[model samples]
Target chain A: MLDSERLATDSKPNILLKGTKEGLLLLLNEVVSFESLLEDLSTLIHGEKKSLFEGPDLKISVDYGERVFAASEIREILDCLAKRENLILREWGPSTAAKLSLFNSSRKFGPQTLLKGTVRAGQRPVFEGDVVVIGDVNPGAEIVASGDIYVLGRLRGIAHAGFLGDWSAIIAAAEFAPMQLRIADIVSRAPERDGKPLRTFMEFAYLKEDSMAVDKLDSLHAWTAMARQSS
Target chain B: MGTAIVVTSGKGGVGKTTSTANIGTALALLGKSVCLLDADIGLRNLDVVLGLENRIIYDIIDVISKDCKLEQALIRDKRFEHLTLLPAAQTKDKSILSPETVKELVGALKELHDFVIIDCPAGIELGFQMAVSGADRAIVVTTPETPAVRDADRVIGLLEKEGIRNPHLVVNRIRPQMVKRGEMLDIDEIVQVLAIDLLGIVPDDETIIKNANKGEPTVMKPDSKASLAYRNIARRILGESVPLLSFEEAPGFWGKMKKVFGAK
Candidate 1:
């Protein structure tokens, strides 16, 4: 926890800031009026907003804490919070802090999945963890996982494997035709519906590889064995 | 858990608005309170397709800008008592509508309606985003032609980008004979290329135009080929497992003649 991130609740279901490993402290309380909460947070942060963090990076994840929020309302809040990240990031991660520290240069979290299902046009799934499938990701379908992703099916829709920007994550699909795939801060688009497809069941994608490489899944048995043995 | 569907396509004149009007009406006939909002703004045509154009005294723009109450802007259809139309403004006031506004409107409307069917425009713009802003899912409508299908694929990608999960695909204007004769794109092929879940496939029928002219959406047109298909789609949206309707029209003249005349 960062020294600057203090915990407070006002003894009510209101906005409270708690900084975690992911960075910007967010205490989401839907009971309080959103406008009043925003006004209060802005006022509280006004004095120390600049010196709040040493680096220009942060992320805010508002958990509704079991409140049933309209999806549109959620979208609105997220869009606004993301803009603040562009101007000044309040979240702090080990990698982010490591980048600023001249000690080392490496990332972690490589365990991921690639799923392939015939995601029908109107079907959508938001996976905040690792996901893997072996079916066609249909058009109009959505996949938003916060971990890693691998699809044995044609990816022609929208997929965001590391939506929260877990930099160690990566995604690899068999045909790789998604309209968009957001892994960490890097987002790659198919550009068009037509593209050359690979027919390999084995492909390895990770931050170490830096690019998606198509191959036989079994070819990386040694890595799998090592990964399994490490645990 | 109610479904929010934005009927959209990349190519114009592919019957997106028509399909939306018909499907919403048909779904309402199934006993769901359906709110069909025209998100096309400047080029709104859903009212015309549903024959509710004259009934619109107020539009979504009116409700948002506080010119009129939301209930007043909602034009209830006499034909299907459960159906209502939040018509698009004929004037240019709706041009400045934002995503948040669209979302809030959808939320307020959804409480009163079971299914909120937004008729999206042909291109990706603020209007289109506004329509999809509150969508939990969607149905991308497309014709069986190359350009339409290609555009559908692109639109599907866009939906994914916008974080719309559970998007169903509807193939409109499909000519089975053309597909069987190797002259048109087939269902499996398009599905393979686009790689999404199939919702309902609608056939190309001449009644579509006639229905549009009468402002009687085809989904409710008793025995029309397209109407039946839209009905099946509504059932699917209601979570019923209806068998996929076959568009493989019985082989044409020469082939049928060959069978009758004992010729190969």
Candidate 2:
């Protein structure tokens, strides 16, 4: 838990502005609408623009709660922060306690099935726990796992991770060339390749903002929560 | 006891029958006793390909139904002294050959021959099941096309499930010129995609058509590239280390020298 010091006291303040050694910390209330929060943040910054700060340079750390932010939402926040002259948004993340709770939420329930051959066409392997395959999942094959799916080879088939609706479940592969990917209830289709081969060492798909998001292991920093906990 | 090897492809028109007849003939040519069994039942074609159709007085159904002795149904190939074929019944359905009957027939063939090569029908149906029922190993025949490769992958999966591990692959009808032009899948691409041990790559040659029409396998034409490829496949199946033939019959040395000198 951060030492959240409330700098403003509205009747029901959804945006908390706090003073830190580095910069101002903006702790957003998870229950409030993002539009209202952003509007409130803007009003507070400009309302006391003359007396609140001394220099033109400003640094901020936006702390989100249990809500998983989307890429668009993060971009929105960054855009809002750039509105201030000479501003640098240092970090944005969920509370440490929320992250810990998320880790504990998706626990291993049963033994994982480890397969060493290609899952071919017209074949589907449905497993209750983690499913790991050391071979390619060819097109027309479907693999459904209640937990995570780690394909050590090319994945050109359909993969459904957390099929029973566990949002924390992930699906990863060496070559992320799936026809379709699903994490929990969120589904994503593979983007049309531009006739150029993508050199993906390892990529994982997870639920982000009620949608399936795929990120390469190289660009792992974008997925702060997952990058923190090695899977 | 002889080893029963089933030549199969999940999709049709991928040269399963051609591979069977050629490889079986090649094995017999290598001084090994081989028995080729056509397990396609009503769609029988191995006998026609082997030119043994005119002498088919008793068929496999006659042997299975105890209407004739097993040796009575065997037809000796005229080209090879050690080669024999137990032809499939052209009129019967695939359901007549149960898994048990296939196993028993393969066992009986094993007692008399060094190699029993079964030509499995296309598609993973009852005919395919009966073909691979008693096999100790398998050879998956596939073309460079997407449908053939996809079905071959499925058949490989089924073979593994049946405890047939590491089935070899033969990519047939590969055109070196088309592969060079990047229009067709190469042998390496097919092997990589299927992730199986490659037995051989048979180049697309007109000799195959000629041999088939003449009721002789391409392996009979020793100078043909497809025949040499089949012989290499047979050698590999016999636990011999035979290097893969380079299907890169591109423009010859004279053409390369001409290009180097900028000669017309």
Worst 10-residue lDDT window, candidate 1 chain A: A98-107
> How well is each residue in A1-231 modelled by candidate 1, as lDDT tens digits?
223332353445355565654565556565776665555555444435535533555554444555555667656555555545443444323233423322222224444555544564445777757888777766566777788777767766677767786655556677655666666666665555343444445454444344433334554555544433343
State which candidate has the highest TM-score: 2
Q: All candidates: CA RMSD in angstroms?
A: 20.8, 12.2
lDDT of each: 0.72, 0.84
Index of the highest-DockQ prediction: 2
Instruction: Report the CAPRI category for model 1.
Output: incorrect
> B44-101, model 1: which lDDT tens digit per residue?
7899988988887888887888888899889999798889999887775665589998
Candidate 1 overall Cα lDDT vs. reference?
0.72
DockQ of 1: 0.05
Docking category for candidate 2? acceptable
DockQ of the two-chain complex in candidate 2? 0.43
